[model samples]
Target: MNDQGEELLARVRAVLSDAGFDETATGAEGVHLIRHARGVMLGWLPEDLAQPRRRGPRRSRRPAPADLPGLRRAFGLAMAAALRAAGLTVETRGDEWLLVAFERAADAS
Candidate 1:
């Protein structure tokens, strides 16, 4: 991973944590979601899940699950909007439940 990727993951972790998600592990291929204080409502997509990957011949090169395109796009847009609403910029890569979001500083006028 590059520096930018590391930074992006950090930002995602921070945002999710603030939104009530717990940090369970720092592993590369783990998915995490937020649990509300009362546990009534779980965190929504994009922020709740990491990019979904299927087991492949080689663990390093797995394929993304099907049925993720639309969901990923919608989740990405929602996350982006949420980040923007918090005065941050978001960029996503990949499709539905597999999208990853990175927070960035808004452009200075």
Candidate 2:
């Protein structure tokens, strides 16, 4: 990536951080790997529960299976908002969730 790309990347990352998300991993060379820090609340109990969660478990805080979809959706929405705010273009390649941004030839100084 060029200097412009790196700078834009930093700005985008800052936006995500400011939006209550954290960079969890270094995904592909150009993609940002981010997730919500507190995670999406399922309005119910976490996994590792013995029953249907009347009061809930006073034990581990492992996320329930149902929470995965909500988490993924939250991440996607945040990413979309950040990209839109940045005026960045995202290309969906097959089944991969990826976001790529750059200065087009005409937009470059």
Candidate 3:
């Protein structure tokens, strides 16, 4: 990851963390997951895909989405907006687990 990548990831971490996903969880295949609810998992996945796990109990389900669609769209939008506001071009890839890339205009030249 480059400096921009690091910054982007940091921003993501902050956004998610502030949204109450402070629990650190590990997913399958060395993937990182932030557990927010009973079956909600969030992360910057490889294929940009992610699914929920039936974790015993949920702490606070406030502002929880009904399904993956809600999670994806809402969180994805937040990430895109944050990245774009930071002057980085946000590229989104995948569905089940969304993959996001941050790029600068100069880097494209």
In model 3, what is the error at residue 68, expressed in angstroms? 3.2
TM-score of structure candidate 2: 0.48
Q: Backbone clashes per model, in order?
A: 3, 0, 8
Writing each residue's lDDT as its tens digit, candidate 1 over 1-109 gives 5566555556666766675444454333334433222111112333335435667653523335553557655545655565456555443434433234444458999
**What's the distance in Å from true for residue 44, model 3?**
6.9
* Candidates 1 and 3 compared by lDDT, better number: 3
TM-score of 3: 0.39
Can you list the residue pairs that collide in candidate 1? 51-98, 71-96, 72-96
Cα lDDT of model 2 by residue, 1-109, tens digit: 5566556667666766776654543332223443222211111122323333447557445554454666555556556676667666654422325454454568556
User: What ranking emerges by lDDT with the best candidate at the front?
Assistant: 2, 3, 1
The weakest ten consecutive residues by lDDT in model 2 span 37-46
Error of 3 at 60 (Å): 19
